[model samples]
Structure formats: C-alpha cells, structure tokens
Target: MSRQTSQKIAFALLTAAAVVVVVPIVLVIIYITIQGIGAINWEFLTAMPRNGMREGGILPAIVGTVVLTFGTAIVSIPLAIGAAIYLAEYARDTWLTRLIRLAIINLAGIPSVVYGLFGLGFFVLFLHLGTSLIAGSLTLGLMTLPIVISTAEEAIISVPQSFRVVSISLGGTRWQTIRHQVLPQALPGILTGIILGLERAAGETAPILFTVAAFYLPRLPRSPFDQSMALPYHLYVISTQVPGMSTEVQYGTALVLLALVLSMNVVAAILRSRFRRKRRW
Candidate 1:
C-alpha cells in the first residue's frame, strides 16, 4: 500500500475510535436529560422526598452530596498537594519513596467497595466517627488521594527544570523557589486534578454506602457527624430497594449527580485555561 493510503487508513481508524468512545457518553447524557427533565421542577428540587421516595424533591440528598463533596475536597486537596510536592520535588530516589509511589499506584487500583469497607472499619468503628459525613468524606478523600497526588506530582514535575535552577541561582530558597515559581506554573494541573478527584468522590456510591449514606433521610444534616442521604445512594435505593419507585425521580437524581460532576469538570477546564494563559513556560 502507498504511504498516503496507509496514513489515511490510520487517521480514519483513530477518528472512528474517538467517535465510538464519545457517542455513548453523549447518548447517555441525552437520554438522562430527557427522562429527568420532567422531574426537575422547583418543588422537586427544593422539597423533601415523600411517599417512600416516590414523590416530592431530593433536597436533603442534594445538600448532603454537596456538603460531602466539599468536605472531601477540604480533606484531600492539602494532603494530596503536599504529598505530591514532596514526591515530585523534594523526595530523593530512595526505597521509601519508591515504596510510597508503589502504594499510591496500588491504592488507585483497589476497588471502591474495599475503600468503603476500610472506612466502615477504620473511620466509623475504630475512630468512632460513626456513619456520618465526616467518615464518608474521609473515605472518599482517601480513595481520591492517589489520583490527585499522581496528577499533581506529574504537574509539578512538568515544570521546566531550568525554572527551578534559575530561581535557585537568583538566591531564592528551595521553598521560596517552589512557592513563587514552580507552584504557579503547576497550579492549573493541580487544580484540574483536585477537581477531577472531587468529581469522582461526588459520584461514588461505594465509599459513601458504608460510611455515611442514610437509606431514607429526608432532612438536611445539621453537622458533619450526622448521617445524611447522598444522591448516589439515594438513587440506588429508589431504583433497586424500593418496590415501586418513580422512574422520573430515579433519572432526575442521576441527572443531578451527572450535572454536579460535569460542573466540576467545567470549573476545572476554566481554571486550567486561565492558569495556562498566565504561565510563562
């Protein structure tokens, strides 16, 4: 075959693969939106569930999911960024560091249900946090840490080595150099990772299932130590556990969860674009 023909064939194959990957996601979103749009009125969004979750709104679940997502971000972002900085910039090529990296990789590979079990055992039982928002947030945070750390570390490492060298040569301390030069450039990627991690944490059912999800709570949680309903678990219960749940309600809950994750992604994209524009190298 001619080189030109081979290149065209390869390009066409790649395009087809891309379309295959994207089409389903687009279809799913469209289907959910269509199914759920009828159920997304003000009363449905603002009121509490009634009639065994077949009527009314999902305010408590919405609030709980938002609060848990925020809590997860609070718990994970600082720790993940610090660990990433250490691993990417300060840590030497030692066995301990290697082991840490390996652990992170393994953590990322572990199933979500395992994290839920750990949360139930460690956070809920051992730490005496009980089945509450804090416990679930911690569980989700732990589950999300590996992703954020891996992405942030790569972002930090991607900063040009010459930038660090120049900062040091200009009489800047190590910490100062990183604070002023390295972090600014890496901020976009770090923010992207943090948002992505939070997005997953927001959507996950398993981590919250054991730690925090209330089977039928209708009120907003008063504190982090209180059991609350989250969208994922709420949707799961209505879809499977309830004998005669409304299809509209189930799809509406899924739509809300999807919207929440997509909103985080949009924010990440915006932040990444703005910061990349500001970056000098």
Candidate 2:
C-alpha cells in the first residue's frame, strides 16, 4: 500500500475503535435517563427515604457525597500540587524522582478494597474516628492522592517549556517564573485533575464502606466527624441491600450520581476552554 493510503486506513480503524467505545457510553446515558428521568423530583431530592425506597429521596447521601468530595479536595489538592511542583519544577529527573513516580503509580494500582482495609485499621481503629465523615474523607483523600499527583504533575509539565525559557532569559527567578507565568497557564489543567480526583473520591465505595458506613442517617452532618450515608453507599443499599426496593429509586439514585460526576466533568471542560482561549489571546 502507498504511504498515504496506509495512513488513511489506520485513521479509519482508529475512528471505528473510537466509535465502538463511545457507543456503549451513549447507550448507557440514554438507558439511565429513560429509567430515572421521572424519578427526579423535589420530594425525592429533599425528603428522607421511606416506604422501602418508594417515598424517600437521597438527601443524607447527597450531603455526605458532597462533603466527602469537598473535604477530600481540601485535604488532597494542596499536598498533591506541592508534591507535583517539587517534582516537576525543582527536583532532578533522577532516581529519587523516578522512585516517587513509581510509588505513586503503584499506589493508584492498589485495590480499593485494600484501601478500605487500611482505612478500617487506621482511621476506624487507631484514630478512633469510627464510621465518620472525616474518616471517609481521609480515606478518600488517600485514594485520590496518586491521581492528583500524576495529573497535576502532567499539567505542570505540559506548560510550554518555551514560557519557562523566556522567563529565565528575562532574568526571572525560577520560583517567580513558575508562580507568575507557568502556573497560571497550567491552572485549568490542574483544576481539571483536581475535579476528577474529587469525583473519583466521591464515587469511591470500598474505603468508605469500612470507615464511614452509616445506616439511614436521617439528618445531615453538622461536622466532619459526624457519621453519614454517602451516595455510593446509598446506591448500593437501594440497588442491592434494601429489601423490597423499587427499581425507580435505585435508577434515580444512579442517575443523580451520574449527573453529579458529569457536572464536574463539564465544569472542567469549560475551564479548559477558557484556558485555551486565553492562550490564543
């Protein structure tokens, strides 16, 4: 085959592969919307769940999910970014950096159930937090640490080297150059990673199942140490644990959680767009 023809054939196969992957996702969204759209209601959202899932909403779970997400973000983002900054902007790309990167990747590869076990031992037993929101948040933060570090570092490294070189040529200090020029440009990507990390933390179940499991927390949490029902747990209870569960409520919880994750993703996309626009300017 001619080179151009070969290239065209490869592109065609890649496009087909993309479509194959995307088709299932599109179908899932459609199926979820159809199953859960009618269940989206103010009462369902605000009221306590009752009637074996036919009358209540997911208020406590929703609140817990949000708290866990935000709390995880608060705890993990700064530490991840600081680590990323040190690795990308300061440290030599030597054995030490390689070891750290490897360790981060390995952490991400560790099973969620193992994380749950660790959380149970440390946060629940050692820390004496019991099944509390703070315990869950700390576990979730640990869960997302690798994601935040790897992604934040990629974002930092993605900032054009030309920008750094120019700053250096202009006699800007390394720290000042990064602070004033490189970081702003990289901010959107970093934010995207942060949001994704939070989302991952929010959807987590295993680690949270051990450290933050709450049975029907009718009232919302007043503090981080308070125990609560998280969204993933709510879904599991509705879909799997609860007796005489209505399909509608189960599907509804799934849809709402899906929407929550998609909202985070959409916001990240908007931020990415604005960043690209600024780059053009």
Candidate 3:
C-alpha cells in the first residue's frame, strides 16, 4: 500500500479505538445522571440518612470520604515523595534498589481486597487501631504509595541533569539543590500522581470496608479513632445489603461518588496545566 493510504488506515484505526474507549464512559455518565438527578437536592446532600438509610441524605458518608481522603493524602504524599527522591537521586543501581523497585511494582499489582485484608491484620488488629478513620487512612496510604512513588520517581528523573549540575557547581548541597531546583519542576507531576491516588482512595470500598466503613452510621465521626460511613461502602450496603432500598437513593449515591472523583480530577488537571505553563525550561 502507498504510505498515504497506510497513514489514513492508521488514523482511522486510532479514531475507532478512541470511540471504543470513550463511548462506554459517556454512556455510563448519561445513565447515572438520568437515574440519579431526581434524587439529588439540597436536603439529600446536607442531611443525615434516616430510617435505615431509606430516607434523608448521605452527609456523614460524604464527610467521612472527604476526611479519609485527606488523611490518606497527608500520610502518603510525604512518604511517597521521600521514597521517590531516594530512589531517583540517591540510590545507586544495586541489588537493594532493584529489590525495592520490584517490591513497589508488586505492591501496585496487589488487589484492593488484599490491601483490605492486610490493613485488617496490621493496622486494625496488630496495631490495635480498631477499624477507625486512622487505620483506614493508613491502609489506603500504603495502597496508594506505589502509585505515588512510581510517578514521582519518573517525574524527578525527568528533570534535566543540567539543573542539578548548575546547583551543585554553585556550592549548593544535594538537599538544597533538590529542594530549590528539582522539586519545583517536578511538583506538577507529583501532584498528578497524588491526585490519582486520592481519587482511588476516595472511591475504594474494600480497603475501607475492613478498616473504617460503617454500615449505617449517620452521625459524623468526632475523631480519627471513630468509625464512619463512607460513600463507596454506603452505596454498596444500600444497593445490595439493604432490603427494599430505593433505586433513586442508590443511583444518587453513585452519582455523588462519580461527581466527587471527577471534581478532584478537574482540580488536578487545572493545577497541572498551570504548572506546565509556568515551566521555564
């Protein structure tokens, strides 16, 4: 075939692949919106669930998800960034480094349910955290660490070596050079990973199911030690476990969860764009 004809065929195939990926996503959003929009109102968002979650809203679940996600971020981001920096900048290629990378890769592939089991064992029972916000947050932090570390390592490694060389030539210490020059350039990519991790943590049912999720708690958690309702768990319970549950409520909960994740992604996209625009090199 002529090169132009081959190029046209490739373009057509690519467009078909894009449509195949996007159509399902669009259909899901449309279906959820149609099913859930009627149930979403001011009261549904702000009020506590009543009557075995058949009435009222999911305020506690929403609050719990937010708190849990924030806690996960707090616990995960610094550790991930530190590990990434060590791996990318300090750790020489050796057996130990290779082992660590292999471990991270393995962690990333582990099932979410397995993380839940590990959290139950280590954080809940062994540590005596007792299935609370703190235990759940720590579990999710661990679950997300691999993602953050891998993304951050790549981001840091992508920074041009000349920047580090210049900083070192000017008498800057290794830490100073990384803190002043490298980190700023890599922040956007690190944030991208963090955003993705947080989004996953927010929507995850399994990890929190064993660690923090309450079946019917309507009141807000007063402390990190307290058990609380989470959106994913709540949706799961109402949709499957609860008898005679309203379909509207189920769809509404799903819609809310979808919206929450999408909003986080939008914010991350905006930040990434702004940082990209600010890049000087």
Clash tally, candidates in order: 0, 1, 0
Q: After best superposition, candidate 3 residue 71: deviation in angstroms?
A: 0.9
- List the candidates' TM-scores in order: 0.98, 0.94, 0.97
State which candidate has the highest TM-score: 1
Query: Candidate 1 vs candidate 3: which has greater TM-score?
Result: 1
Per-model lDDT: 0.94, 0.86, 0.95
Writing each residue's lDDT as its tens digit, candidate 2 over 130-220 gives 8888888888898899998888889899988999999999999999999988889888878888988888888888888988868677778
Tell me how many residue pairs clash in candidate 3: 0
Clashing pairs in 3: none
Question: What's the CA RMSD of model 2 in angstroms?
Answer: 1.8
Those runs of model 1 whose alpha carbons end farther than 4 Å from true positions after fitting are: none
Per-residue alpha-carbon lDDT of model 1 for 1-281, expressed as tens digits? Answer: 99999999999999999999999999999999999888899998899999888889999999999999999999999999999999998999999999999999999999999999999999999999999999999999999999999999999999999999999999999999999999999999899889888999999999999999999988999988999999999988999999877788889989999998898898889888988887766
Over the full model, what C-alpha lDDT does candidate 3 score relative to the true structure? 0.95
Q: What does the lDDT read for residue 254 in candidate 3?
A: 98
Winning model by lDDT: 3
Q: Supply the TM-score for candidate 2.
A: 0.94
User: How many clashing residue pairs are found in candidate 2?
Assistant: 1
What order do candidates take by TM-score, descending? Answer: 1, 3, 2
